[model samples]
Target: MFSKEKIILAYTVEKCKKCNLERKRKYQEGDLLFAETSKCDSCDGIAVIEKIFGETIEK
Candidate 1:
């Protein structure tokens, strides 16, 4: 019998500074995310990562 494999991913929440609207997205450590360049859905302004949640992969 083979054991089940464990797959991990991370979920992050971002907030728009202009609108205060929050959004959830998949997060990775190596990703180059800048609030200045990233746009928010509600305000079309810069979006910043507010918090990180859920299981993350260990590598």
Candidate 2:
């Protein structure tokens, strides 16, 4: 039998500046770049995608 592996991407949520609220954002494997900056929609806060890593899962 052969096993299949899948790559899982993860991210950390950031707080909004104006409201200090945290929102759940979708994280795609290639959507974000390492050490890239983003924005918070709720409060328009300055956010960044500091860390990104991949995990292998057996399927």
Candidate 3:
């Protein structure tokens, strides 16, 4: 579980993007980016700002 301070990307369904997602994206408070909910993995992939790219970053 990541804290709000750790939030990097917020994932939501395409439709949700029209509302909640857009609101957060507009803020861009940090490394925030919005991805489709279906694409979400951990934490529903919501509010996940830190990308643990040690060995997970595979092109």
Write model 1 residue lDDT over 1-59, tens digit each, in one string. 87666667777777788998888888767544434436887779787777766773444
Residue 46 lDDT in candidate 3: 38
Per-model TM-score, in order, reads 0.59, 0.41, 0.14
Candidate 1 worst ten-residue window by lDDT? 28-37
List lDDT for all candidates, in order.
0.70, 0.56, 0.30
Estimate the lDDT of model 3: 0.30
Query: Who is ahead in lDDT, 1 or 2?
Result: 1
Model 1 per-residue lDDT at 12: 73
Whole-model alpha-carbon lDDT for candidate 1 = 0.70
- Writing each residue's lDDT as its tens digit, candidate 3 over 1-59 gives 75343334432222232223322222232332233323233224333332211212222
Q: How close is candidate 3 to the true structure, as a TM-score?
A: 0.14
Give the count of colliding residue pairs in each prediction. 0, 0, 3
Estimate candidate 2's alpha-carbon lDDT, on a 0 to 1 scale.
0.56
lDDT sort, best first: 1, 2, 3
